[model samples]
Target: MIEVKNTGKPDERRDFPRGHLDVLDLTGLNFGVATFDPGWRWSESLRELAGTDSCQTHHNGYVLQGHLRIRMDDGEEADVGPGDVFVVPPGHDAWVVGDEQVMVFDFAGGMAEYAKAKG
Candidate 1:
């Protein structure tokens, strides 16, 4: 089977303090486009909503625009920008690094659960 979706019209959209995520649900995958405004930080914006100290969702993503800095629980870090393909494991924090808004496309499955209020 084949499936197609335009992220501009997403199946679901989740908004946080300084960012938002648009998601498309396909046959066996959940794809997402996340936009983070400058000053958006996972620890500051999403920790309370997620009920976790650090992001626990794994991400397989491609940076589409602007810059993002990610730091792992163990202190390893990296900056991703346009055209960069990245895989971020669970237990990490991320923030927008510049004045421009950061856009990223995520192919990993866990984004569906990102920033959801804890039950």
Candidate 2:
């Protein structure tokens, strides 16, 4: 098991809409850290990352700050705020809830098995 302390490693930047993202921890678990800048929006192309309706994985995370809106493939949505812990299943999509920057710790690397279903 590897422990990741946010303070130790420098965040790697990735381009997003209206803002940017710092991605880390993509070694084995496929899991990574994401820091969303204010008013940030994920690329629509990433919608494909949602896998498929049947593909499912359990995701647990804590919101460091700000809020986020999670939209499931079935059109279900949830608004998450600071200090909130969330679990996301398969067939879902998410985005920043407001203008506040969102810091998220996520675990979903195991879901790669669903890749075949993506096509």
Candidate 3:
């Protein structure tokens, strides 16, 4: 079987402060394009909505534009720039590194429920 799709039209779009996510769900994969604007921080933008002290969603993605920094709950941290592929486990905080918007393609379904209101 073959599945063809484009980011131009996602299955769902989720908006959060300073950024948004475009999600595409397939038969065996959930993909997402996450756009984080300058000054966007995961804790400040989605913590309340997620009801977690730190990000609980695992992330497997590649940076397409700009830079991003991730700090794990244990204090381990790293910065990712264009052309970088990263896998971040749950329990971390992330933010845009500069005044540029950060664009990433997530293949691990991290954004599946990220930045969504918890009820």
Candidate 4:
């Protein structure tokens, strides 16, 4: 897979929710990479429910910059930062830590699938 970098140029990028994945595509499976800036954060609402967990698929990824935290279904938490790789299970939540931006790459298509699958 190829690697790409985010320039962190605010004016050049479009605005998105504070805790949301801005990009999603099958091609990313081969080049799972992302660059988070300053206040970027992952959504917690995407985690799979326990008893009613859906047929969701999750994959781990590595952090290229800053830091992030993942909260599992059982309430276990983990911290990740530059050069750190992490696996996001089917049932969990995640977000950025402090004011630093977080960059992440993933091999799995990711949580946004629920909406597309439902639609």
Candidate 5:
């Protein structure tokens, strides 16, 4: 089977401080295009809405623009930027790396609930 979807017409959109997520729900995947503006941080922006100490959503993503820094609960951390593909497990905090905005194509399941209100 084959499927085609456009980001221009996302199935759903979630907006948060300094960022927004546009998702396309496919048969076996919930793909998303996440855009984070300068100074965006998961803890400072989305944590309250998520009701978690850190993000609990896993991400398989490809960085399309700018840079992002992810720090895990165990103190492991890394930075993803343009031309980088990354996998981030649950229990992490992320933030935009610089003054530039960040854009990522999330092929994993995280976007399915990213930025949504908890409970």
Candidate 6:
């Protein structure tokens, strides 16, 4: 099967304090567009909703605008900017790095679970 979706017209949308995620569901895959306003931090903005100390979602994504910083549970860290492709494993925290809003296109699955209140 085949499908096409404009992230702007996402199948699901989630809003948080300084960020939002738009998700598209396709056959056997899920795609997402995440936008983080400056000062947005995963730990501060999403931890309570996710019920975790840090993010547990695996992300295979491309940085589309501005910059983002990711720090792993092991303390390893990296900064990604526009035109960069990155893979972030579970167990990490991320934040916007500059005044500009950060936008990322996530191709990995499981984003439907990201930042959702745990049951």
Report the CA-based lDDT of candidate 4 relative to the real structure: 0.54
Give RMSD (Å) of candidate 3 vs. truth.
0.8
Cα lDDT tens digits for candidate 6, 1-119:
56888877999899999999998889888888999999999999999998889898999999999999999999999999999999999999999997999999998897878866677
Report lDDT (Cα) of residue 67, candidate 6: 97
- Model 5's number of clashes is 0
lDDT by residue (tens digit), candidate 1, 35-107: 9999999999999898889999999999999999999999999999999999999999999997999999999
Q: What TM-scores do the predictions have? A: 0.96, 0.61, 0.96, 0.58, 0.96, 0.96
Off by over 4 Å in 2: 1-7, 10-15, 18-31, 43-45, 48-58, 110-119
Q: How many residue pairs clash per model? A: 0, 0, 0, 0, 0, 0
Q: Give the whole-model CA lDDT for all candidates, comma-separated.
A: 0.92, 0.58, 0.92, 0.54, 0.93, 0.91
| Sequence-dependent TM-score of model 5 | 0.96
C-alpha RMSD for every candidate? 0.8, 5.1, 0.8, 6.1, 0.9, 0.8
Per-residue C-alpha lDDT of model 2 across residues 5-118, encoded as one tens digit per residue? 462363455444444434444456544456666655433424345434332546677777888787776888898888888888766666677678887766666423322224
Determine which window of 10 residues in candidate 2 has minimal summed lDDT. Answer: 110-119
Pairs clashing within candidate 2 = none
Residue 15 Cα positional deviation in candidate 3, in Å, after optimal superposition: 0.5
Candidate 4 lDDT tens digits, 1-119? 76454433221222344532334433344333455556554442322222233324476687877887777778888998988877777766566788876767665656334322231
In Å, residue 27's CA in model 2 sits off its true spot by 9.0
Q: Give candidate 3's total backbone clashes.
A: 0
Question: Which TM-score value belongs to model 2?
Answer: 0.61
CA error at residue 1 for candidate 4, angstroms: 14
Q: What is the C-alpha local distance difference test score of candidate 5?
A: 0.93
Model 6 pairs in collision: none
State which candidate, 2 or 5, has the greater lDDT: 5
